[model samples]
Target: MTVHGADAVDAAQSAGRTQLVVGRSDIVTPLARERARDTGIEIVVGAAAPAPRPASGPATGPVSTRTDPTPSTGPAGRLTSLRAFMPGEGPPPPPLFPPSPALYRRGAPLPAHVRIDTRAVGGPGSTPTSGRVRRVTVVGAGNVGMIAAMRLAESAAIDEVVLVDIAGQRAAGIALDLSHSAPILGFSTRIRGVRTLAEAGPSDYVVITAGKARTPGMTRSDLVGVNAGIVGSLVSDAVAVSPDAVFVIVTNPVDEMTEHAWRTSGLPTDRVIGMAGVLDSSRFEALAAQVAGVHPRELTALALGSHGDEMVIPLSQATVAGRSVADRLGSGTVDALVDRARNSGAEVVGLLESGSAFFAPGLSAARMVLAMVNQTGELLTATVSARGQYGIDGGYVGLPVRLDRSGLAEIVEVDLTAAELDDLQTAARHIGDRVGALDGAGAR
Candidate 1:
């Protein structure tokens, strides 16, 4: 059956039909596909209708410049042969089928359109954006960076994600692998790999996961010196190209590295951030969920302070189904969860023996980047400058903040017990000491 334009959709709607089936030869206009998606009308393409025989008469049209001596006998094949086909000469034909119906749920409403800021440059005579042209760059191409890049590309929020590494070919290989998966994963985000940060320039956000990962016996603190040098240089180079880009620091000793990045980039405190607390909070939520016998989504948890042994998980703010976790699982079990959350990274390192944790860390970093680019104003834990929040005067600390394209939009202050506040202050002081040592070593 031939499917016309949006009229077909209107006709189907009027008929109370939820789906339309068309033959392969039937033409479904672009407007029809869009209308189907908008109105929850499923379009399925079946077999092609057989081409009818031409009138039993000689052809009257002008003869082709070239003749095919061995044209096929089939009517459809003959018709195709008669046409003057040229490659790469015009717009491609639309797909016979639309995207999977799951994408356009039968009863679900379409996603709300995001408002794009027209003031942002889109070249000389560009129209307002459709919120699909943002770019992100993930430096390092290591486990963490690779996972982060994959997550970002899979998000499909940004138009492109450039993966950079010192080993250019390795990055390219990883990008190629991820790019190959895009068709299967159903994302249109472009992935590119490059040797230099220069090629990843003009990015909207830069995620720095380049650093010496901790081995089985090493603590995150042990990576400070080695990773500081790596992170500092990457931030400097990235800032030179992406001056307005938000820098996400995912290197080890994250709080200290975040401070070093902030100081090195000479960008505003809000622009440079660290991915630590979110991962830690996720760990805490997972453990709490196990104990509470509830899905992790049902539990709201927050882990603050530094991202190391000194990390503090405040029980006051953690709840299970709106009830305090402590009340649900007692203070004893909750304390045990807190301790485990603090040492979760080391536990993973010990378990892997050769590599540190990357899955959660990369996902956490990607989540922060998505929140920023989408301007979702999501409340998240990030390592940002401590401007006297929680009585911590300087240095970077993990705190709850709202994220946007410009990075940290607001530092959300939640009520904490006196003991929790003390622990947070202690963690802040530890981070400050580490950052000071980096300064002393001129690693900043």
Candidate 2:
């Protein structure tokens, strides 16, 4: 049957047709090809229908290229061959089986009329990008990274989550293990693991958790120098494939490592962020709710500063079911809760006697990533560059921020008590000192 164009193809598709058969004379539009590619419909045009093989398989003979001369349809005669499959050297494969992008990408010359859509291809050209991240790449594949990948994969909005790490086998194994739960979880997000950042392909967002975990008796500050190096390498690798990717840094010292990613990638200042405030604030709210005898969701807590012991919790700002937590728990209990919030990471470290927290950190990292991908403009605490307000310049520190697809959409500075402001300043100074040292030592 004759078809006019994409509209006809759509009509046919709506009528439950699974394949499109066209002659060499037919004009198959690009939209038709694109729709076919997306809808998994086979296009069988130009090529003669294949002859059925015998029960025992068809008799074989030497194959040779030939042309059909019996009848002419289109201006150009259909090229035929003795073999069942069409020759690879002939005209484009009816848009049914287009040339493998791999051929053009591996230094292989592109065939005629087959220029790579740099926006559609992953490698060997401009980095692929679209409106927002259907794909989230998680760097590290450690406890936090792995957990974040799993959480992202569970999101219905995400199409893929690629986990890349230096530990290739481990990453692959974890990916495979998580894949088994796809049926159980009823999610369609594809999860994969790769050894190299390039193998993760291009992504709209890259969540980074690729750094050494803090040990017992250690502050998040202690990981600054070593994690800075790791973050620099990871950010550089990610930027190579995903220049526009919004970065979510979860490594400690998160403030400094986020600064490293921002500087190393040279992306827009708003595109790189550290994930401390969410985890820290979540910890605070949970502890506050626990003592106040309320649901954790009813309490809202904010932590300003670093992700470590020096962080500040404005108890005056905290609310439990719309009332001040200080009013509910009194000043003394609130002080202990604040201290616990500051030292929560170390507390987890001590309990495990090895690794630090992953559950809460992973939850926070995933939330930040989704906020960016979904462009929710949600408010959360994250480590961002210090500039514009408060006069703190040239370092990363925790602050309440409005997050969206662009990363740190807006920095929200809540009214801080005098003591809270001093705590934030002290944390900023420590981060500045460490980041400054990194710059001086050329570790950055």
Candidate 3:
């Protein structure tokens, strides 16, 4: 495989070249891309050159006279004439894809070959009903917040997404970039950026993702004190303008942060939800699917309670193709999957050595927003007030919650074994202690 490094980019820049072309399979280094961006160099992917053909005849001219005893047939040999393929050096390359068929004229009758299906597939009609637009305010321009805003905008369920960050320029840049992709991505949802929450008023949902990210060797609980203040302040300010908006907290130590947001906003217990359980459950499902040799989308898994070590993954509930995970993969594998899922965030953080996971967490938050905006009433695991459920009281715990336009519609109680219930309660108590300490220490 071809390896594209920063040295090659520097060489191209030194040669006064504005573009660097590499094979499609070439491994482009991150530093190369960064350098290219800094130097205004456009990196283009090109097709691999054809293998060298064996000599057909004896040496005839100077071109065929000088031949090395050993010939090179690697990337270097293939790229010896790369400049021939460069723009303005030769004829234009062939089209990568065939042109789309001209089906019909705009303003003309339906084409004879086209037949429309009158059946209703799903969802409400395309446009918002009565122009009752829905808006979501994402508080943060961090990795998780940026990805969450992108996912929410792509969903086409919300009319607008406002990204709020203290770094106003960064937020605006990200918003502008995402907005530019809307036409190409086939989504019309508007994306905007602002420096303060006041500009994001009357939002239907406020997703709280502003907080310290977990670094290597740092546990989610380690961020409790630092994130509580940030999340609490954002939630309090969010409620001032969008009092009816549901608050989805994505800050670290999410279970405790959900409680903090709830208290700060003084909203109903059902309105403030944490974004851990869904992400944890998705991880569990993906891991279980890998072990069971099945597609992850076909597996149903639930991870509840705290978003940290005490997170509970019940063997009785997790299933693949309607079969219990324990029965399919045995208890030992289930245990391993549970442990992996519980520590997946830390695993990513350790690997990155910098930022915690954002892709799954962001999508998880966006999924909750989509459920709320579309009023799908889908049952998803999330952290909500558990004052009387599972014999746990006075804390926000992760559980199966049905979401709709009204936010939390119902808390679905599933039958868990005694041990599973104990584990869940253990997680709840852990979150409770951390949350209590936040208040006791005057964190927010």
Measured by lDDT, the strongest candidate is 1
Q: Kindly give the stretch of ten consecutive residues in candidate 3 with the minimal lDDT sum.
A: 98-107
Model 2 lDDT tens row, 106-197: 21221223322222222112232333256889988889988888877776557789999887488898898988988887666788898998
Error of 3 at 281 (Å): 0.6
Q: How much RMSD separates candidate 1 from the native structure? A: 18.0
User: Considering TM-score, which of the candidate structures 1 and 2 is the better prediction for this target?
Assistant: 1
lDDT of 3 by residue, 280-370 (tens): 9889988888878876754666778888888888777666654567889988888888999999999999999988899999989988887
For lDDT, candidate 1 versus 2, the one ahead is 1
Error of 2 at 52 (Å): 77
Which stretches of candidate 3 lie above 4 Å from their native place?
Answer: 1-132
TM-score of 2: 0.69
TM-score of each candidate?
Answer: 0.71, 0.69, 0.71
- Candidate 1 has what TM-score? 0.71
Taking the candidates one at a time, how many backbone clashes does each contain?
0, 0, 0
Clashing pairs in 3: none
RMSD of each: 18.0, 20.5, 19.7
